[model samples]
Target: MNPLQKRCLILGASTRAAAQSALYAGYHPVCADLFADTDLCTIAERLPLQNYPDNLVEQATSISPISWMYTGALENSPEIIQAISKHHVLWGNNAEVVQAVRNPQKLYQVLKKHDLTALHLREFNHPPPANSRWMLKPKRSAGGREVTVWNREAESYYAESHNKDKLSTDYYFQQRAEGKNYSALYLASATQTVLIGLSAQLVGCHWLNADNFTWCGNVAPVLFSHQPEKHQKLAIQAEKAGNVIAKEFGLRGLFGIDFILETPFLPSSFPQLFPLEVNPRYVASVELFERAFDVSLLKWHIAACESFEQSQQEEFVTTENYSANFSAKAIQGKAILYANCTFTFPLTIERMPNCADIPSYGRLIQKNEPICTVFATGKTIESCQKDLQERSDEIYDALKIKE
Candidate 1:
């Protein structure tokens, strides 16, 4: 460890991406996650947890005082965030902010007030019309876990077997929005919000071994459509929604909004963006944008948190600037390759290029769990996605043979 370098603690399900960003931003990162991947160990100090999330607070207490931040899933546990924040300078949203932003009801109210389209939500007590399509989502979940399309018949069976009232608080129904999924990244200060870039989301990809609404990966610099007018209109809507949500929740630092672009069948109609969920911290797709734009998002995130005012306006990248600088031909993407079968990871995987979140050599990876991430780049979205798929296949083939 460099004595002159400042230490930053990162906690998440996978901290490899954030750790890399921290390194590029000139901070020595101390990380703890579900998997202390081989690549992560090569870059930053790793603290293994006997029981993830449950013992995160205990482990965090053992580290020396330093600034810290959390990534996905942790936002679902505001109490844990609150406990850890007492010991370190938090460089991300506080527990209160996390709670407010994660609350579907609160987010609904904010969108309604702004006259923006929001995902229709139905609590357990109020069942939706049987004909309308809706999805059942867990109240405390991340990465699309436990999310399923709502079926009236299945719901009836569940109601008979379980206590409806008890389950009501834990789950809710959201009207299904059929369209392409996308996420918009942003940086917010006390008074201003800047759009970083937008990415196309990959959900429930069977090829990646992800099932039933599970998040798989992302492709950056996506547009609503090939038409220039339609793309610009959609981008504007996303920017408007981001600014409103950030101001309403007092969100500071980097955050992402996962939304759906409801493209109309009629050419005369413009596509509408339905804001689905808010990830009030550094999201999974941040690295794709970082690669596409060649910028250190963590550096900007920390800067935004430390300085609340709009004095660093010149340094921030807005939606207009992002659109202007983004190349129409270049595309970057990543896919989280999940294990199709349980097996011990080969040591040779540590040397593979363009792969991240690599597990330890000889680590046991169970069926359907993430193995590592594969990256690719090309001149178009199709080529980029194709390259990522080919990379995933190559990795899987290597996993088949014993070292």
Candidate 2:
């Protein structure tokens, strides 16, 4: 596929979801991930620029132009990303925007400055305290890989790895707050940024009934019947963060932000809203929600990528039909771990407009990867969540990972 004709450049581990973005945008996708898959139609490019750590501008010159580029999990620093973003053909999002949300330490500081309450955080490279429980996180990572709560002993092992990685002893520590996790996506250009899509995200909820805290898969258009105020607060907090970030970093293009709601004051009630972490790029679940909502988030993202200076209050340019749907995933094991597990279970998939006799809109049936990605739309958020769960549960229970 020709690079110039493409709408976006996708990185990271998920292909199905990435492909969906490409399809929705009506542009080709130039994929550059750490894996190899034939199903990804576009020509693959280098995963990461080897010699250009600081000067990504030069490295990006190696690839062809894209209407917009959505790449890997961003790091804590934006300088590196800015270097590369300059060379892109389209004016998609730059690196500084991503860096703002990537670093827990930096993000907390800014949130505090903005009069927003964020997670209780601390960063350390050396030993953890004896009685405290904490989560050990990679300075830059995604998909909950190596992000887990560590007891005193577990903290020691992670600290050893951190030392090997040349990590700072005072990396980041946060008082783990209990709350619902949700995300919103926005677009920005050099002069303005706009909120294109608002779907409640689902993650880090597996700990509710687990022996230890486990990161769960994400679903969209939240179904948390328990928390309304917290959810709204988090959304407002996200807008504030984006406002500050767009001005501070001169951020442009497509970006996503994730936050946790905090409210321990009332056990039976939802917790208060608190911004936990921010993701400054396109998120994982955009694929499923876009399908259900009948909106083209990809196009608006492209339009915004053309300019990064847009503000949150700018005129709306995106389109959406419905407000809810569910796309769930399950880690049945490596057997079903083909690609990055775009859609796992609990999805009510349907055939696309023209896909007849197709299995769930001609979804993949080969066990070599995911059996299929289920998608269902509903009139209400609850209806969407309920149908999503029913569909996702049925598929999850029926499929046995063929190990």
- Highest TM-score, which number? 1
Model 2 agreement with the true structure over 292-314: per-residue lDDT tens digits: 45566666666655533444325
Where is model 1 poorest over a 10-residue stretch in terms of lDDT? Answer: 314-323
Q: How accurate is candidate 1 locally (lDDT)?
A: 0.85
Which residue segments of model 1 deviate by more than 4 Å?
130-132, 160-166, 223-226, 308-329, 401-403
* lDDT agreement with native, every candidate: 0.85, 0.50
lDDT of 1 by residue, 160-196 (tens): 8564554567888888888888899998866578777
Off by over 4 Å in 2: 1-8, 36-39, 42-68, 74-87, 126-133, 156-171, 189-200, 204-216, 223-234, 267-270, 307-399
TM-score of each: 0.93, 0.67
**What's the true lDDT of residue 205 in model 2?**
29
